[model samples]
Target: MSSSAAPAAPSAIPSEVFEPPVLAEVVRSGFVEGHHRGSLVVLAADGSVELALGDPAAPVFPRSANKPMQAAAVLRAGLDLAGERLALAAASHSGEAFHLELVHTMLAEHGLTADDLRTPPDLPLDPAEAEAYLAAGRVRERITMNCSGKHAAMLAACALNGWDRAGYLDPAHPLQQLVHQVVEEAAGETVTAVGTDGCGAPLMAISLVGLARAFRGFVLAEPGTAERRVADAMRAHPAYVAGTRRPDTWLMRELPGTLSKMGAEAVQAVALADGRALAFKVDDGATRALGPVLARTLRLLGIDAPVVDRIGHAPLLGGAGEVGEIRATF
Candidate 1:
């Protein structure tokens, strides 16, 4: 269930090589200007495949979509995180003031500091926040990195276990090893590859279907279980999981009991209260296509709410006026 060899490279085959279907189209002035090719999968409440496109079986890095599972791993490794703390542990936060405040609090509670984080210094993840930061002449700092909260939680877990904090990001570390195990178990599949994530942590590769299954497992796990706790914390504190302007937070806020997470490179995984789940990735990594595609996918499952409209509201512009839009193809 683990590998020591170098992680295999993701399939770099051209989108047309396997005839992967178009998931979305960029329409400008009512003309189809471009297409986004990718893979997607949807699972019914019973966990059976209801829809699939492209090669859903192919392995892909789910990126930060794997945070909830990683947070569960931290809990399993003996971190007593809960509520907003647990939610932030599983967040790709927008680096808003509130998120930074809690991150600082978490580090202080655990006798850690910004220096303990291994995430590279970066500006806030939210555009508005980044703009304000630059306007104020603030330079990038490790604590402002979007992944700092997760790193703080990791350091706390390391402290709890009395493990070497310096090597916490190593793939072979005890905590990450446990994370690998939990990921495999929750996804119900063997991790086919490994790599370094944007946050400089080990990344495990699993199929789109496996990613969907993992999200569903989290929502449906027995109460008080690590998976359930992570799901609950994230759902209850949607803002902590992402931020005020993020779709993950929006979707969870509008739809109770829904679990939602989007990762870098246009990866998204979601599960409903009834256990219906889905995962998708844009082959070209065009995040602009993610919204329309995701909204259409939810429609197939009979989910049509105002939030869907909000999520799918990616309008194209022309000289400060409405032009057209990016929309789902199928």
Candidate 2:
């Protein structure tokens, strides 16, 4: 419980995060070229893995992909947020007007101020918004940070539990302990190692299997339960859950009832209505590979989605128009 608890030993970076035989390739004109290595896991209805690439057992921090479970915990800790509010709590939202306003509203509703947020203030995650802010000479504020919604939820949980709002980001805080409990239960896996997220909250070392399992549980939870509520809310307001142009938002909008969340460092988790799941991490941490990889995995599940074209391929630029593409090699 001490703040001085030794920092976790840095993890050995995996030699390859993706499963065998290169999952994607960069081809220039007529020549075959560079490729990405990563891992993928597809779960059967019975919870057995149907396919695996690379080493799904290797641990990953899962980044924002873990937000739904954290949102579930906040709900468990006492907060009745629903619809867009609930979705935003599990969001890595682009700092759009709706998203920023909602974060402000949540803080105001809980009698907390932006000063109470422990997450560091940063410019908008959306490139356009960031550009606009810079153009207007606007300064960074906690409410406009991508993780503001999640931070607001954390503060609300503190208010509900009568815990110190100022220390809510501490790993040993009652709020975080509740989060750990929810994560373990949802993942059906033991959590050991820890790391700090970009947002400054404690992150757990969990394998792709555990991450997949967590999302599987979320999709299949009892209709009226907190887990199901989070899933439903995210599905209902996919736009708020991510942004106007994000894969999470697109997938949820185009494929209703699918639970989708992406994390930092190329981590992604997607679950079907029946609780089956796929979770993966791109070895090189290439965000470019995520769309193609997830699209391929979904194809294996018998879905022929059109969004694949929108997100899957990474184009190679050349003088004479399009000269190359990043195609899935697997």
Question: In terms of TM-score, which candidate is strongest?
Answer: 1
Best by lDDT: 1
Q: Tens digit of lDDT per residue, candidate 2, span 200-318?
A: 99887888998999899899888989999999999999989989978899888888789999998889999988767999988888888888788878877887878756767677889
TM-score of the candidate numbered 1? 0.95
Write model 1 residue lDDT over 1-330, tens digit each, in one string.
896999989978776546789999999998998999999999999999999999999999999999998999999998999999999999999999999999999999989999999999999999999999999999999999988889999999999999999999999999999999999999999999999999899999999999999999999999999999999999999999999999999999999999999999999999999999999999999999889999999888899899999899889999999899999999
Q: Per-candidate TM vs. native?
A: 0.95, 0.91
> Which pairs of residues collide in model 1?
none
Per-residue lDDT of 170 in model 1? 97
The residue-level lDDT of candidate 2 at 3 comes to: 71
Report model 2's TM-score to 2 decimal places. Answer: 0.91
Off by over 4 Å in 1: 1-16
What is the lDDT, from 0 to 100, of the residue 125 in candidate 2? 91
